[model samples]
Target: MIKPYFLTALSGLFLTQACIADVNLESVTLDNNPRVLKSIALLQSLKSPQTAMQFNAPYVHDLKNRYKVRSLFVESQNLPIVDIQLTFNAGSARDEEVATGLHGIANMAAQLMDEGTEKYTANEIARAFERVGAQLSVKAYRDMFIVKLRVLSHPKKLEPALGMLMEILNHATFKKSSINLILSNTQVGQKQIQENPSRMMNVQFYRALYGKHPYAEPISGTQRSISKITPLQLKQFSNQFLVAQNMNIAITGQLSAKEALKLSERIAGNLKQGEKAQALPEPIDKSSFDIRHIASDSSQAHVMMGHLGTSRFDSDRLALEIANQMFGGSGFNSILMQELRVKRGYTYGAYSTFSFSQVPGTFSFSYSTRQDQLLSSVQVAHQALIDFVTQPIDLNQLAETKAGMLRAFPNNYSSNANINAQLGAMGFYHQAADYLSQYPKLLEKINAQDVQNAIQKHLHPERLTLIVVNDQLDKTALETRLKQDLNPQAAQPLPTENLPNILNPPEKEVIDLPVSFPTDAPEAI
Candidate 1:
């Protein structure tokens, strides 16, 4: 006998073929067409079996390096290309070490690294890479600075690309002209952030949550901070953080383990053996609800609520990952989406996410709605979080989430590039070498009770920090409404003294300092 799912699939395929054969969909009017509408309805009704997919684990090789540079390699002979990434602990978080107020020094240094080295002009550098069909890119995040190179596996192509990368790392000159260009672009971005509601809310949110910590500042830095960055500071930052001891290497594609080790050593030998960056201080957790209201002219309200969450090293990290997926991380199946978008039609989308980084990261839920519906949406989202934290997990949904994750797990390392990325992250975070192989078994062992316990231990609904960008009311009125709606059963009303004074933000104060310029400045445009 033909099974139900097979019959449904066969029917769907024949119907699809008939529609394609009979109709010119572009020419047909869709408004009142009976046959087309009937076909669409029939297609929507078709279902497929949710069977688990098995995938073989990719073999990962750990290459030994004597230069203190950790290395992970995976050999893929199918492609005639190589990908290399060097991840350093020199992100914006280390800016303060360069100077007290140099928030963007790391970002500035990264931008200037490849512009001009001691041996080549910026244009020469560009043409050299182009001649070899190679690509070099640099990016700085809150936790790490990454330099990536991609080139064909042929010796001629790989040799020149590797040489250019080393020259940039060891002898790049951070000229004054490049500094001025980045500063000008950052100033424009700061102005644009002020005018954008979502960006403004993000800036204020971090400030409120991490008062005096290093993470309080944005990676881009503020106008006041960026203006103070100098060429000397950029050089100091680069020298201190970009070192063999402070970074790791990830190599993938068309390379034997022996060759990969030699390549890793050559790359590591070019840099100074500088000390590792000191560990970052953890951001303090809030005790009470801290709310801020940014008055905007937008008819829709942008809201974000969260607090400091767990770190990458936490034992319950995997459980919290699953819990977050069930709560708001998944699109339509998430609890927040079902309550806010599907049931009430309050917003088009609602999402919750967790960031597990070097220190405790943030767990946040964000959504936007009409100004008049702001309070209702906030209440619904908050209540959903409360119930999720305080109640038992739904066992059926937990099973479904685990199954979906298992099926999708193979996609994480499906290609050489993707596998290299995973290896890089694993080495940086000090995970066991068998982490990838063990992830599925560990995840399967996480029961519903474990998920519920993890949620209860990590998530704090009562101590959330809230930020809203809306034009509906003044700060005082909005504060009152939030207190009433969120804590209706409190014998005494929720306190507003802890709220930030958002109405009168201080103006940027500037101080002038003498600056020096390189004698061989690039010619002005």
Candidate 2:
């Protein structure tokens, strides 16, 4: 490392330069001429933000069934490496209420596909990917199970990689030993995640708000479901729910349109087609109008509060998109972050987001503050939501939000992974395949009045189901505060069952208890 003196001297030089460049009153007065003002404006115009442009390359979607096969393909070969992705909608949503995390189960099940297949062992698959610098990844999200394979420039190598990946995606033994070990490891992970109050708060919050909307389930899934996810059940779920209609495949990077179409045919074709999927039920259990406080042993509180909002298909989706950015989704400029973190120093950082599912999604505000500041921060966030819905969004602020949304799209879809993710999202929501293409225009159409209208139509802060995970908080005081801010009738004490038994023991049984192992340690008996 450079010596401290050298670093200090370099800093001093920069500081001196900054000081010399500082403005004086006389300099400001002298520079306030019409020509100077005009020049400043001209420079500002020259430095204008680049408008986010659309990919002019026409998106080609062609599904083929050649030689007794069926597969869907969208060909856009922009790079040398051709990507093949196969997806199925056999996510956790397909799990029973008891099997809450089936989506996670499906995902974990897929990972074992390459562990050892009927024809190939784990070592062989690893060596293949290693030899060719290819990669295969499997993941289960809220709505789908995804299998992605990437291979080199050679079509011959790419075809073999795709074949190997397809075998994994389509037929996995999900060996019993692997399943048991995965479940055991998952329990360990579950304990760690639940230990974090934020994760705990979000999980319980979703369950409370959505009640039974598949949206209520955890993304990865729960331990109970994972444990009971027998290999046979895995096969059934894959066969039933993971069908063609529920699947979407997206390709980007390295390949020609004709080759892409051919590749898609070779991979997904002849995978028995299923019926068109219908829309999922909305989180319309709007009756869950409650405020829940989950006490944990922590210094700062983890808070997440919001209610059901719009779906991707809603006309005001674009408006809500802009609304979310203005609220807390846009980093520093948002009111929640500005007030809760920047102004009050209550949190390190704060942000609010409204997640849209196929159905009415949740509009949530989440943040953490010191134990003492918990209730106060929650109240401020609540009030901000209320204000956002009731008041008219300012035109300048509205423009900024829309501009940010518009400007961020290209970056969002910059990678093949990103493009596929967005496509998957849009496809899951039954959105127009052209939604991305029409995004800039759709967002441009949103006006100031539309934002305010959307807020009123979708946001119901008063009806929010608040979740605050704070340790040793004054429960009575919080209830009182909530009553004063929201409706008096809505205020209710902590429900006995709302608290998840994450710690696996009652507070009374463990608190301040002395450790007494038998004087001589207990025997194996």
Candidate 3:
């Protein structure tokens, strides 16, 4: 008799075959549908697309206290739900070099804030939010730690949620048991990173790109670092960094400005006054080409390349944003995507982004492809970047990119949550009060020449550091390909042992190469 599993597999095969054979191609054809044709005709007859988007930027009411607590309120009377985003200047950037993993203390402290408070156990805190249909989220990033909450604006739901939030902020116990559990889970996560080639590549890429910089450190502490974190350290970090003056709050929802201000004051009144975090030492601008290839058993290669990018303060940021969109930011319309994926079919996706921050950030172009196609894919991507700066972008392409950005700008304030987040970012980043209002005007004034100028000032193709992670079996071929495709003087191989310690040493081996443009090549951008 046939096995049960075999019968199930046979039934699945039969169902799939039946689906394939059931289609009536003629009946489903667009030409055979009169209603579809009529709909298409009606849609085509509509007036031309709007050339200008009308956006009424939200009014932000700013308030502060003698204790230096800052808050921004955006009134959204239509929605019943309220969103509050509280941000602290404390981020991984403040992690001490000696205690390299102290940032994990901040992260762990945030995660455990709701686990238990002075007045409530973890179960009680969770149930309190659940009963009120409220949501709470805590996140730690390179630049800041955030605690966000959403709940119905009705007093019955809002009051308890606010009380619980205040309790968590003031009385997080940071129990030893919770700390140990989070640390163990984090270690498990680190071990799992070993199995992810893309994440492993990023760890090495950031290390090579931002040498000796705090940004070089993984946001998640290493195995040794995580193990080193203790309860006392976490409490100290929270006491020092999670104070009133270092925090900014943004609230948006059905509440009146008066009610929002009252809530903000309640939250801020309970905290101790503290000073803003000290500025990080500026990262050295070293553009020497570097490439790291982590040996993986996977059949495909992951590639990332670029160099230090501009800060958010740069005047040319808007222009660079548009230029990037025209080059590799737009989906299929981007030049890199069209060249590498659409034309050559080397990979399913190719994209580029400029991760601008309060400090200088990175601009990277990344793609993944079969190991054998790695060199060709890189060559194509490299050429695309060079061309993007050297050649003038078409006027129509510039128009389309600008239009797309402007059209999507309103979505940034589409909901209470979105508006709260955007307002929070503006405050955290020290953006001008009128930043959102002036954004459309800025986009409107930019032209193709402005974009090219921005490209020239911001992007440096020749100084890019290329990183490729691929199967060890292709190592020899990749080395040969690099020599032929890039300058020999600029290409220096690194020892496999020098890669970031977070990743497991390959079963085979690794290849590291430093690449630079030819000496006779055109100027930086």
Candidate 4:
């Protein structure tokens, strides 16, 4: 009853429908089969072979002016970016003992670099860089002040940026208005820091640890000191510390050795050839263990405990670093974290660190817990440290710790900025140029016995100073706990007023008075 063409079309439609039904059934079977899905996941879980990191040392050049420049030329033909950092061995540590406020002056001077120059206004200077997508930043650390610039490598962008930077370095005006603004901001910041319990704890801890050492002084000068700083003092500080002899230049990214050399010369040539800063004196260790309690109206108590630690030049630094990682520096796997957070639920986190400086630095273990648990938490953390140093770590723990450090080492140089920072540190600390390349090897050479020896020799948990900042601490309970868990003789109560008042000045009221002018008729008559 149907025509031939219609029959052909009907047959083709039926075949197509059958093929689609088969496909749908196949898909359903694949999705429903657990073994097949597991097999697919297993197939996708392949990983590439792990490779060891190889560090390339930078080309070191000495400029005619006695400035040392370290250049690392990363070849990136596809990209056009360059990073330059000029580090001067002029930080808070160099602030004269007689002129303690010079620390704030140095920091403020670094900040004022881009505020304005003889040739460019502040706004204009900012626009010059913003238009070309460049960035300029200044940082003042405990040991150094750094001026950094990042810009495109093209001549148009690079030349102008360099010129602007030179202008800032050689001809910065440090206007009175800018100085006043910086001083006001610094005062406000210090006041805010005073209100922060954790910061106050650190300030107190450092004061206890360093004693009369300059390290005890806050990096940002105290309110009283900052208020006394003048624009002339800032200029004098710049002249003394920011000199050719005291500077190191680090250049990275898309630049040749010759170009970097020329740039470094240009940057350092205009700088004054002043003498290097005087060296810092060694920090003296406290005679006995001490505990200081600061009263605060906070629900959580902040505790910091430890003492003076080794310097960058310590022979056992690598071993101590690994030992610290196992004891508390590592996250959840660390002994302190496990004891305080997981096993006892005493705190949310606990950590220990060794801060290595040019001179001797500090080792600190810190934690925060509910006010009620303050003493108990301190006892637990203190015991953990004592046990870590007294007991020798087994081979497995040592292996795991070393492995973790090695795994994280490559991340130290993961970015241009990080690499530059490391380089700057090496220069500032006078570390060998090959220090980065040799670090992993040194870490590998450390053994279980080495770690144990370093801990036993350097870490003195019995001498740690415990500082607690809490409003709710029960003095009777704290005294009882100390007698039970620690030496009763070491426990001492400190008045909150005795705490460092670097930020806040004694409260004073403003009094308004009528002023008499020379031209006032009544006063003249």
Best by lDDT: 1
TM-scores for all candidates?
0.83, 0.78, 0.81, 0.80
TM-score of 2: 0.78
lDDT per residue (tens digit) for residues 126-183 in model 2: 8878777799887665555677777776867776677677666566677788888888
What's model 1's TM-score?
A: 0.83
Choose the strongest candidate by TM-score.
1
Instruction: Locate the minimum summed-lDDT window of 10 residues in model 1.
Output: 516-525
lDDT of each: 0.79, 0.64, 0.74, 0.71
Model 3 spans > 4 angstroms off: 1-53, 64-66, 101-103, 473-525
Candidate 4: lDDT of 76? 32
Separately for all candidates shown, the number of backbone clashes (residues 3 or more apart, or on different chains) is 0, 9, 0, 0
Root-mean-square deviation of every model: 11.9, 11.5, 10.1, 13.6
Which has the better TM-score: candidate 3, or candidate 4? 3
Error of 4 at 216 (Å): 0.8
Which rank order by lDDT, best down to worst? Answer: 1, 3, 4, 2
lDDT of 3: 0.74
